[model samples]
Target chain A: MKIGYLGPEASFTHHAVKGAFSDEEHVPYTTIPDCLEGLITAQIDRAVVPLENALEGSVPITVDYLYHDADVHITAELVSPIQQHLMVHPENESRWEDVGRILSHSHAIAQCHKYLYYRFRGRALETSTSTAAAAKYVSEHPEENSAAIGNSLAAHTYGLKIVEHNIHDYHFNHTRFVVLSRNPILDELRLESEAEKTTLMVTLPSDDRPGNLHQVLSAFSWRQLNLSKIESRPLKTGLGNYFFIIDVEQSFEGVLIKGAIDELEALGCTVKVLGSYKKYSIVQK
Target chain B: MKIGYLGPEASFTHHAVKGAFSDEEHVPYTTIPDCLEGLITAQIDRAVVPLENALEGSVPITVDYLYHDADVHITAELVSPIQQHLMVHPENESRWEDVGRILSHSHAIAQCHKYLYYRFRGRALETSTSTAAAAKYVSEHPEENSAAIGNSLAAHTYGLKIVEHNIHDYHFNHTRFVVLSRNPILDELRLESEAEKTTLMVTLPSDDRPGNLHQVLSAFSWRQLNLSKIESRPLKTGLGNYFFIIDVEQSFEGVLIKGAIDELEALGCTVKVLGSYKKYSIVQK
Candidate 1:
């Protein structure tokens, strides 16, 4: 089977893909939208992309695109702890401080702001398309004085040397990635999951006032449906307009889940069942 | 009166400050934290900074800093319509297509992706410290052949020509700015408000399960207290650990808000009242 991931190989998403789909053929898409578009358009059997990072919050593009464009359902979640490192072309190992510029993806760059400030103060920082791209650039441009911040995999892939290990500022630097497929997976491939989760998008009435959200929550509360995550994204129509993305800690097959969704619909909330999926911790390769 | 705003001048935050404090002395700080620091350190009378945007959800730095670092309280909210424009150095105004790079703050650049994709397909897109900085860069570097995406104020302030107006991809482009002071303002100035709002940060028990949030909402729902916004931000501790930022559409002086906060505390949830302040629509000058 073919699996797609947002990558140039050795990205954190690529690492998650490698950890989860050992037996499958991996396809790399250049961007998140392209990865999702590939899933819905059947370019690949399934697609995996990062959803949220513990320190940085949600990947806005992924969340926004899921609600606005994609016609896919999440089939699985992959959680991996992120560890950023500073790397350079091996020749720069002895004097990495002389590097004129530092490059990495914006998120990775943000994750290491403190390390960069204290260690590489006054150096120019640049954003590449991906952390792997930055690694590749450093690998190719050995004549230039530059370093890259990326994962260990990236350093190995690009034949670069790690100058600093685990340089990310925050300790709990984990990112949650999700697998998307056009239809539900029927256990065709062996994917180990620790728990089950069902995600719902709840849009309150346009004339929604304060207590309206309380009413929405009441539907699930009385039924004892456990919620794992709840987030609000812009409805994109105007200021003060929003729709909540809720994650309930159960499968959609249960009657309680149905009853709660029904109550929400009955109470004038526009409800969309995004997925009922399995959650997995990464098996680091 | 003295006011501090996140800026190098002509930024969206500066616009909000200008609209609200017509007679006050305006001071510009390079970053949000700096503005808040100025407020708390008494270097300025008050600080105005962007809290959230309509198209872009909450400003993470603003949200996280408010919850974690600043000792200031929000006194007033300023909501203003955002209109992004494409501007070029006067020399390149007639031959805008010849511009080699398009620069703006990351958020502004994201807002105009569609416009940039179609209009300046192969141009290098760069991130400046702020939108106003982008305009200033283009204005000062006329020989570099660059364009900037920013507000009309930036173009006017930098003496650049606006090649295109209202270039943001989304229509409901608005930003919510807040005034931060060491203590709550007691209507010392004539700041007209459409409504009163109280912001609370609630940290659920570590062993939180599904229905915990539902019970938390019940405290407000039963009292008929309205909530204008509800968002969950990472506690930066670990995955699955979150704190809810709840915005109630009422002042903290009321018994209803006090009752809800008290109940939440009794339920073993740590609740912090971030602010109870006036919300104002921009009195655009």
Candidate 2:
């Protein structure tokens, strides 16, 4: 099997693909859209993309692409603990005060905002396409006055030295990754004990009448079906227009899920099922 | 009266403040947290900040700051149509092919992703703190090879010329700004004809029992109260924990609003009224 992930290798998505599908041949795509497109074109059998972060909330591009741009289905979910480290070129030994610039992906920079601001007060901050790419740039340039924030895997991959370990501001930072495929997972591949989650894209009635969304929620609420998450995204039509992406803690095989959809459609909501899959978590020590 | 807004001047927030409070003396704060801090310190009588955008969804910093950091109340709402333009230094005559780099805020860059990828493919894209800041940088540098994506006001403020108008990927781009004050607006100062919107910060029952959120929504649904918006934000305590920010389409004066709160509290939810205020829209032609 082949897997595609957002990369320049050693990125969090790369780690996710490695952790989830050991021994699989993996290729790195430059962007999230590229990974999805690769899956659609059969350049790869599956794609692992970050869906959300514990601290940053949702990844809008991933959500937006799944909702509007792609015909892919999420087959499985994986969670990985994010550990950001400050790295330098292997041959360069510069004191902390000698550092003139810092580089990382925007989110990594944001996650380490306080540490960076206090330690490297006047240093120039730059964003790269990925954390691994930042590490690669630092490694290739061999600048004594520059450092990169990335993972240990990136340090290993790019032949860089880890100057500081776990520099991320928050300790509980974790990113959720979803495995996407052109076709849904077959029943034979399903794990019986794995927890199921069904994602739905729902558009409420256009009128701002009282109880429109409430009516939609009532369909699941009254059925005792648990909703794990609910997010509102703009329909891109205009202001004040939105559609809700809901994740229910149940599979699509049951009557309850079907009944909820039936009730919602009756109440004038257009519903589309994005996926029904088993949730998985990979804990990195 | 004095007002505070996020600025480096000619920013959307600056425009929002200018449009909404034409007679008030407006001061610029460097960041959203600074604006909120100004309110807490009584440094300004009111502050206007972006709350949400039509294309991008919620402004997380503004929402998170309001919910967690400060005790300020939202007194009014303003909507502004966002128009992004490709701008260059007037003296630097540059054709589209001559542009080697583009600069803007991350959101602005993301908004113009399609246009930039197609027209200025492989160009170096950099992010600044604000779109206006990007324009200022481009103006001061006066490089023929560099341009900026910003608003028309930014072009005027920075003495730059618009190379292309409406360069944003989507047409219906709008930003929603909120007027925040330390003290609630007095009844005498309230406009009777203005439409009301009450924003609420709600924490559903901590236990993940089925129907907890549904029950909370049912409180308003049964009262036939209209909920204009519902957004779920991470509580930051841990993953999978969230609190909802709901905006109702009515003021807090009546029995229905009060009844909804009472019902929610009875159902083991903590509710905080963030504001009850008039809605304002500034249309740019």
lDDT of 2 by residue, A142-223 (tens): 7455889988778888988888888876576567788888987722232223578899999988886777787788789888
- Cα lDDT of model 2 by residue, B1-285, tens digit: 899987758888887777777778989865566677778889999988878752222266577667776898988888777788999888765565587788886567766767876888778877565688789989998744589998888898899989899987667656778888888772223222356879999998889788888888888888888887887777767777788999898898878999999989988899999999877777553
User: What DockQ class does candidate 1 belong to?
Assistant: acceptable
lDDT of residue A117 for candidate 1: 64
Q: List the residue pairs that clash in candidate 2.
A: none
> What local lDDT score does residue B102 receive in model 2, on the 0 to 100 scale?
89
**Native-to-model Cα distance after best TM-score fit, residue A185 in candidate 1, in Å:** 4.5
lDDT (tens digit, per residue) of candidate 1 on A211-261: 788788888887888777887877878767888999988889988999998
Cα error of candidate 1 at position A231, Å? 2.2
Question: What class would a CAPRI assessor give candidate 2's docking?
Answer: acceptable
Model 1's C-alpha root-mean-square deviation from the true structure amounts to: 4.5
Query: Roughly what TM-score does model 2 have, to 2 decimal places?
Result: 0.81
lDDT of 2 at B211: 81
